[model samples]
Target: MFFLKYLPTQSLILNYQEHFPDGAEPKIASRLEMLREASLLLRDLEDFFRAHDFSLTRFLICVILDRADEQGGLQHSEIVERIDVSSPVISRSLKSLIDERFVCVESETEGRRTKRNRLTDAGKARLQSLMPGYYEILLK
Candidate 1:
């Protein structure tokens, strides 16, 4: 006895019930539609990132660093865990960011080696430059 208040057409609902047989679960269908929409949004974001010569991972790292705690920054291991990327991939991205002067790293030896990363002024600017376009795409 599920009901959809905003169904496009009665005929569409009838067709859906026919296809589904037992009953038409509009909520499940709506959830699936939402997932599809999210996938499309991600695709758009990826395309935008590619056109800007920035990989999504790199952009995400900059964002993470930008929002990191004020105490200092996140360690390499913490970043790896947060992003769910392999150490090698994270290392390569960090190296590229460092080369581009978008990020800085500091190493410490508090019992064990720790490398902390934070965004540079340039990184913040880069992210800021992209935000307008990102927001426009999302709004559309």
Candidate 2:
């Protein structure tokens, strides 16, 4: 029942009911379970990165940078929106990346607060290096 929530909302509920006709099916409970599983997986991955002194937040930031627009770059705010993390969280992560030489602020846009973040050579390589292991856990 709890596991059903992890799936896409519409499909998950119907699928769960089909599988477990006798079980109670509640959207809230299902979503909660899904959130729990997602959190668990994130924790597991975070622990994995921590062992190697890598921050998961930074890794996610790097991922966002890799998915740059057609021009191969993105604004910092876009990163925040895409990752669905708070500004402070993204700021902290970006700092880590800047320190590690993985990313840099390429330019300041029209707005005073908006800065375009670009992946440096090292940043691109680092992301590429991490993808295999990241996807291994991610896909699992």
Note the Cα lDDT for every prediction shown.
Answer: 0.80, 0.75
Model 2 per-residue lDDT tens digits across residues 19-116 = 65544567555656678888778877887788767878888887778777345577767788888779998888898888888888865655577568
Could you give candidate 1's per-residue lDDT for residues 17-120 as a string of tens digits?
75675655666567656666777777888899899989778988988888893747788888898897899998999889999999998765565567789898
Q: What is the lDDT, from 0 to 100, of the residue 50 in candidate 1?
A: 93
Candidate 1: which pairs clash?
A: none
Error of 2 at 25 (Å): 3.5
lDDT of 2 at 81: 84
Candidate 2 residue pairs in backbone clash: 5-30
Q: What's each prediction's TM-score? A: 0.74, 0.68
For model 2, the stretches where C-alpha displacement exceeds 4 angstroms are: 1-33, 69-72, 108-114
Q: State the displacement of the C-alpha of residue 75, model 2, in Å, after optimal TM-score superposition.
A: 2.1
